[model samples]
Target: MTPREYCKIFAAEARAIPDFGAVPEIIPLYLIYRPANTVPYATIEEDLVGPFERYCVKERDGSLAVQSSSEIAQKCCAFQHWLYQWTNGNILVTDMEGVGWRITNVRIATKLKGYQGLKESCFPALLDQFAAAHRCNRYCEILGLKSLESLQQPAKPKGSKSPSLGRKAPSAQSSPQLQKKGLASPQGTRKGAVSPKASRKSTEAGEAQLAPKHKEEGSC
Candidate 1:
């Protein structure tokens, strides 16, 4: 969904919750699942279990709470129940492994944050849980937010070049080269410079040249 639509969903859901006051500053969390990779059992225990224990301790004092989707599911009984309701039991307890449960929780948490005064209720521990589960640190960079020291910027997708950095997206009339490449005469150029019919004929001639060579090889 578009960012604005995402924001709206968060607002509506947050308002529906009892005792969820004004919204907090909402940040969108994008979760990408990578289940094919082997999970390092030691790393998972250290990273997930360790901090989770600490988070529960902090929650008792009202100083920290879980905010992200997965953490929220783990921490809040109400939210866990809500998940079952929302998914119509498609996500059973056994199905939580490698599932993006935390991503959904983070979305709900952020929406609640947008309500009048719920940011404090949503704790940093929760945000951390969301970040860990869904790798939010990388997404934060895409949205131009702070990057975690452990997180590297996501690679530019293969064969997909970004438009020049700092350049605005080009409009139809913006690039003369693009106009020429599209076989449209550049605006105000000489008539002979670009002829649509001639361009078509030239393309046909080039294809013909390649075709005869292919035919000759087949015959040989």
Candidate 2:
């Protein structure tokens, strides 16, 4: 519901401006579920055919872990950056996944913690380090966002380690001098549009080896 609402908000924002720059249009999958239903998923998402690529565009702590070489992917990352600034450092969407341009299974990290299913992702610490962890990608500038680092960051937790590049005010296209904020900058770029899918290990053969059971009295 959050993703759907956000998508609507962004779409409306884009429509309001006479000349909004090109941006990635994210379409979130809606969930239709009922308790005690036999179906695993009520609204099963269409599984991807061929090689399905999954990439982590942003980190929980607001850093660009994968500054993807693909322009589209970069735009996706910038959306996350824009959201933080749009909300005045309130909510940030991360843990992006899915194939091609449609991102699903995302995680939302915000300052106000402990909401239903978002407890792990919404911890305030993630947003606390935003001004430190975030690196301004080009699309962020295209959206008319100034260096996000210029936005005053909340004080980090005591004894937390600072980023390797340290803290610095953001520039549209330049890296600012580092200040003391606990987090790391980009480790490196994950180039290429599609990532190679890793194989998932099958369940233990031992489970299949369990003794066959007789039917319980009057069952079914």
* Top candidate (TM-score): 2
Q: In angstroms, give how far residue 36 of model 1 lies from its true place.
A: 19
Model 2 TM-score, all chains together: 0.52
Q: How far is candidate 1 from the true structure (C-alpha RMSD, Å)?
A: 27.0
Query: What is the lDDT, from 0 to 100, of the residue 56 in candidate 2?
Result: 46
Model 1 agreement with the true structure over 1-220: per-residue lDDT tens digits: 3323433554467567554444322234444455676752322111222232211112344333334443333423232223323433222111122122222212233223333344433333443443333333222232333333233245576785667866887788879787778785556477547788899999999998999899999999
lDDT over C-alpha atoms for residue 220 of model 1? 94
Residue 184 miss distance in model 1 (angstroms): 74
Instruction: Count backbone clashes in candidate 1.
Output: 17
TM-score of 1: 0.19
Model 2 scores worst on lDDT over the 10 consecutive residues at 198-207
